[model samples]
Target: MNNVKVNVAQVRYREGESVCFDLVEDFSSFDLGTEILSFQAPVHVQLQVNNTSKVLLVHGKIDTKLNATCGLCLETFVYPLSLSFQDEWIFRAQATDDLLETALILDKDEIEINERIFEQIVLALPMKFICSAECQGLCPTCGANRNLAPCHCGENDIDPRLAALAKWQSKD
Candidate 1:
């Protein structure tokens, strides 16, 4: 269910050879809210490998389409995800200073590349997912969806300040 290998042996980097491949990522198991939004990870791990310095420069943008409830209205709408980033990964850094520059270090046998790239995509996601800015959330009084229709209750409700006085009059 987790950590499925998305990119396997796609990134080919010799001591000095440049290689790039198309990356397509889909989320079959990624469930945002009881639905698979296909906004999981990189569809393809398209990379340009420089064999000379053992660096893989990645440049690509992905489209993530998912339905998010409107923050105000609570209505669901397709939220388009436009995420693009350029990553520089240097392998086998002989100099200690060059070590930190690498985004992620992997063993020779490790064929997983989703962790490094996936983090970037996640950061691109909106902090608070809403369908739109002007979404009128569910009505507070009758529990009606205000976006769909107007509530029967008046906006200016009965004045609670006069409730005690009304109670006194009712006793008479």
Candidate 2:
């Protein structure tokens, strides 16, 4: 879990004035509804917050390590992750349609960015995690990990559900 909140109360409401922050937050794990993510190290973040009097412009970079499971081999591996992000925070009273849809409407000067960071991290991950390009997945018949050793199972063993499809092909 990450609890990262930035306070902009002391920042001057000027165009060129900005506040810089360097933070390291400990993150254990988080549930993404579909999958769970575990962090191998603390999240390092560097942020520059600029107040434009109307909106707060935030630009930052995040770096961290993750313990991820390979989708093909189901083996756990350490994955290094680094990403950069930029966001706009507008006051609820000053929000307008002219601003981009990604702008965050804030009711207070204190902004919590943990959720946004998590969303970014999840979006940056690949659709399927493979340990390596040459990873050999589990054998369907014997349930053996093919990456470790070769399997001697018969290759023509058709699944019971697809037996009809095999017979249909043989008919041709």
Q: What's each prediction's TM-score?
A: 0.62, 0.76
Model 1 CA deviation exceeding 4 Å by range: 1-18, 30-54, 93-98, 109-111, 157-172
lDDT at position 159, candidate 2? 88
What's the lDDT of the predicted structure labeled candidate 2? 0.82
Q: Assess each prediction's global lDDT (C-alpha) against the native.
A: 0.57, 0.82
lDDT of 2 by residue, 1-172 (tens): 4689887776745666799889889876876665687999998889888887777888989999988888887888888999999988777777888764768777787878787777778888888778888999888888888999989897767788699888889998
- List, residue by residue over 21-44, the lDDT tens digit for candidate 1: 565666443554533444434344
lDDT of 1 at 128: 65
* Candidate 2 backbone clash number: 0
lDDT of 1 at 88: 60
Worst 10 residues of 2 by lDDT: 7-16
